[model samples]
Target chain A: MPNLYQEVIFWALFAITVFSALLVVGQRDMFRSALALIVTFLAIAGIFAQMNAEFLAVAQVLIYVGAVSVLVIFAVMFTKDMPHSTRSTNLQPVSIVVVGLLFIALSWAIFQSQWNEMPAELPVFVESTLVDSSSQLGTAIIRDYVMAFETVGVLLLAAVVGALALVRDK
Target chain B: MLERYLLLSVILFCIGLYGALSRRNIIAVLICTELMLNGVNVALVAFSRYSTPAFMRLTSVDASDSVKVLDGQAFAIFVVVVAAAEVALGLALVIALIRSRNTTDVTEINLMGN
Candidate 1:
């Protein structure tokens, strides 16, 4: 039942995301790795679009591909010494084993779990509402989740202050 | 559909985890963390889109509909906001590390007063 268009896009996004993530880990140059990270983020955003989460896709592009990628590039700019020290032991074999184990465990859980069809009286298929998520999201932030919303604002404020204090001359 | 999305999310998370753990550079680690967070966001949004109750879907016409739960989008927004803050603070720390040691290796900066 898979449409060719969706399948094509999904597989393309998946390939780019995984490949760029590998680039992020394997590239000797930190700047090139940072650029690869941007590709990964953008591909993930495309996946978000394929999922029909329009608002989230936009936010992913704006916040992640735009802001976070820029911040990471600046960090890479500051830390240019990573490429020089090509230590033989820079890679960890244990991490690969651990990640493989985690992937197996997660796949098992995903298959065994009944998340797609919960026992509760949930819809068989959630109607994709790509048109109204932004309005709905804005409303949720203001009405039901207002307290958490304010807390996030305060957290950002504190983060700014903390960053300044950390960088200040001692 | 849900399974496909979840599978991608899980794989993305594992890749990010490996990158964070195996890579020596702190910046690579940071990028990996961002990738992991994006994976989590994907899962959250997928759940939100796929898990709505039938009654909520039918009855929720207005933006103020309490029956409808846009919790996933809300959580994703919070994650994005917090991640921005985290990157800001994290880069500052990275800069400090660079200034102090002139290096970006995670193994070199031991603050244990050795």
Candidate 2:
């Protein structure tokens, strides 16, 4: 049986995730949407915490909510008069019905999958060696997935340089 | 419990997809993308917990073991890092587009001829 605290946390995170996601889609103001997106990120981080991936929870907060959301908001601030053009074109009834049908089909497929039958048990956690997570992660990136890690770094560098070039005035 | 979480993930994903496909504003589309990413994160962590031994047999698995918990945690870390990179690139592109077009509407960016 799950603990009361865990259950509560799950529900809270679930509510936040779903509600903020809805806000992201439904809100007219782009800034509001961005703010809702931050809430959604936080809720997801909380889900990570529930999953016993504490490092991921912290990273989610630090990287996604802290960095990505801010970058998007900054871009929004620099580019547009967001308040003036808050309202987007409405979706047609036919499109909404189609999307609704698609959602149902997808949900049904997910429901039918046998997720629990092939349970690969999680490894044990050692409290004394909790500090090794970052190191282990670093080692994994350097040893096993070094190429992919380096490629991601290069991609980031390219993005930065490309942004500068794109934003530069002729 | 897994059903509820999965349902929430699906809802969030669809909302994001709708925003991405339907919205004309570029910033709105970006926000939608972030929402989609968050939805994916929720599902990943949820699956990790649902399958983890600690979570499955809560009374038996000690709370202190960290190595056992690294797989999902590591994947989440990588996802976060990639997301950061994606946002940086995406925002840069948006900035560039805004500078060139003087507008952020998808409908308005018709410079690429067919």
Best by DockQ: 1
Q: Write the per-residue lDDT of candidate 2 for residues B30-109, one digit (tens) a residue.
A: 77777777777766756645644344356565443334445455565566677777777778788777666677877667
lDDT of 2 by residue, A108-155 (tens): 987997766214332334332334555655554566566777787887
Q: Candidate 1 lDDT (Cα, whole model)?
A: 0.78
User: Mind giving the per-residue lDDT tens digits that candidate 1 earns over B15-44?
Assistant: 889888877777777888988888888888
Q: Go through the candidates in order and give the C-alpha RMSD of each one to the true structure.
A: 3.5, 4.9
**Interface RMSD, all models, one decimal each?**
2.9, 3.8
Q: Give TM-score values for chain A, per-prediction.
A: 0.84, 0.80
Per-candidate chain B TM: 0.84, 0.79
Q: Which segments of candidate 2 are over 4 A away from where they belong? A: A82-95, A117-139, B52-72
Local accuracy of candidate 1 as per-residue lDDT tens digits, A13-122: 98998889888878878889889988988998898787666777898889888898888887777665444464423457888888999999999998888764433433
Cand 1, B chain, TM: 0.84
Residue-level error in angstroms, candidate 1, position A128: 7.7
Model 1: CA > 4 A from native? A81-84, A88-91, A118-130, B52-69
Q: Give the Å error, residue B9, model 2.
A: 2.0
Candidate 2's DockQ: 0.40
Question: DockQ for all models, in order?
Answer: 0.53, 0.40
